[model samples]
Target: MVYIRRSNTRVVTERNLDFKEEFQKKLSIIEDGLKTYLPHEDEKPEIIHQAMRYSVSSGGKRIRPILAMATYEMFDRDVKYILPVACAIEYIHTYSLIHDDLPAMDNDDFRRGKPTSHRVFGEAIAILAGDALLTHAFNVIYESALTYSERMKLYVLAGKEIAEACDSKGLVGGQVIDINSVSIIDTSEKLMDMDIRKTGCLIRASVVAGAIIGGAGSSDILYLNTFGEKLGLAFQVQDDILDYKENEIFPDKPTYTSILGIEGAREYVKKLSKDAIDSLNIFGDKAAFLRNLTMSLIDRKA
Candidate 1:
């Protein structure tokens, strides 16, 4: 199995300055892009609008949108053409977060250091907000596709895949399995399967959307999808590790680490990250930012 050892001896205290700087720069661009796409103040149903904005503006990594933008930049530098779709990806991600934090789901009271959507807004409004954002994401993609220079068939493909990835068979299904697993005796294989569906599906969609919009060929798309799959797995493993570590220090929820053990989870993340980076070798020098981003994902603290 592919694996890379952590360069930092202390996982909790370590910070890579270069990775942080690059992530922040990309995050700023993504934030600006999202702001440009948000509904204007005059839009109807002000509470729903406010909740949607509140959910998105809660300050996470913005990794999905950045992945879309960076993947697009790999083959094309025209940021203007891709910004709408990037924002759409962010909208979908934020919607998932909002739903995931509900009392019926993860029941998370805080997200990205702030009150979750359900905590600030009532659960009914939070649910409506998530639904609205998910639907609005499609609208953004359709409108943005109209502005493309060549009437891209690939954009159409990306749009279809994005819809598929967010549906019952994708992230939502994965979430269902995750919630069910909490009460049952979950196996390692089961957890991995659930993670790939829940988290890996969107991650795959982000990379594929970037490749499609960037005009990458079939081979490039396949390689990037492989990279994204591995990255998604690594991301989940890292989350497990963090969850386990946090539970040790303070009150927290359950995680794969609670099931798999901390060392095993860390090792799993290392293996996934290695495979993710290995997948990029197929692109030669064309995927430098993608490669760097994969490495940064493994090394990231938050």
Candidate 2:
């Protein structure tokens, strides 16, 4: 049985309005950082650059980067130090989305209410754009780390965490399993293994990376890792529930709702959400923002 930490400290410590306002401020910062970091659309080899810019500029929750920044904030106040790595995580996420939407993959026509990279830029360019983002992210990480000569080692360790999370040991491995196991994903164990690796690893990496950059102690990092994993699973489960509600769930594909039923899935989301918030108890009131954010995710309408 998974241990769920219970705290007398409530999750709703902050007002909804304040939380939303703060979240938007962070979102705006992330948007600016992304634009700053990405290549200009008019750069030489214009098409790939444009495609890259287009996909990266496209709107999303920016949750991964925000998570990293928030985790860093728990220990350090100057989030600028974590900005490059945070944006790097978003680049990785965008690259995955671009590749996932290709004809060879999910064959999606749209993302974030806009045309997908392949749909707008054609398949070859989209593929190249994704590759560019993936490669560029590492450069950003490396170059940014050099700026902080004193904490260079921390940056290297954090970058390594990000790399492993997205490579064969994590996201890619899970994606391979997902693509191949449509028919074989019969048990919750198998399904969760895929979900944790595909989705949880990066989220976990984001939190852990932030903690590392912030100079967190090993035990603190361990707690944050658990928080990220629980939150990641809860986030995906909530997505499954929302997809079901919207009639967007593919019948042939296995999902939490399909495996556990809607009510069961809802209950699972609640449990995971609680566990995720509980994992933040070590932060006390300093974690109010993250705790509220965690609650908001499971309760989100969209």
Q: lDDT of all predictions, in order shown?
A: 0.81, 0.88
Report the Cα lDDT for residue 186, model 1: 54
Off by over 4 Å in 1: 1-22, 246-254
The digit string of per-residue lDDT tens for model 2 on 1-302 reads 11224452253333556788888988888899999998888999999999998999888889999999889889998878898999999999999989989989888998989999999989999999999999999899889888988889989999999999999979989888888877879877888999998999999999899989999999999999999999999999999888885443536778998788788899999999999988998788778778878988888889
lDDT over C-alpha atoms for residue 128 of model 1 = 94
Ten contiguous residues minimizing lDDT sum, candidate 2: 1-10
Candidate 1 residues 1-302, lDDT tens each? 11223664454223344445666777888898787788853578788888888888888777888898888888898887678888899999999999999999989899888999999989999999999999999888888777674745767888998998988899998988877776653577777888888999999899889889888889889998898889988898887776565446322334667766788788888888878888888766666667767776777676
Q: Would you estimate the TM-scores of all the predictions? A: 0.88, 0.93
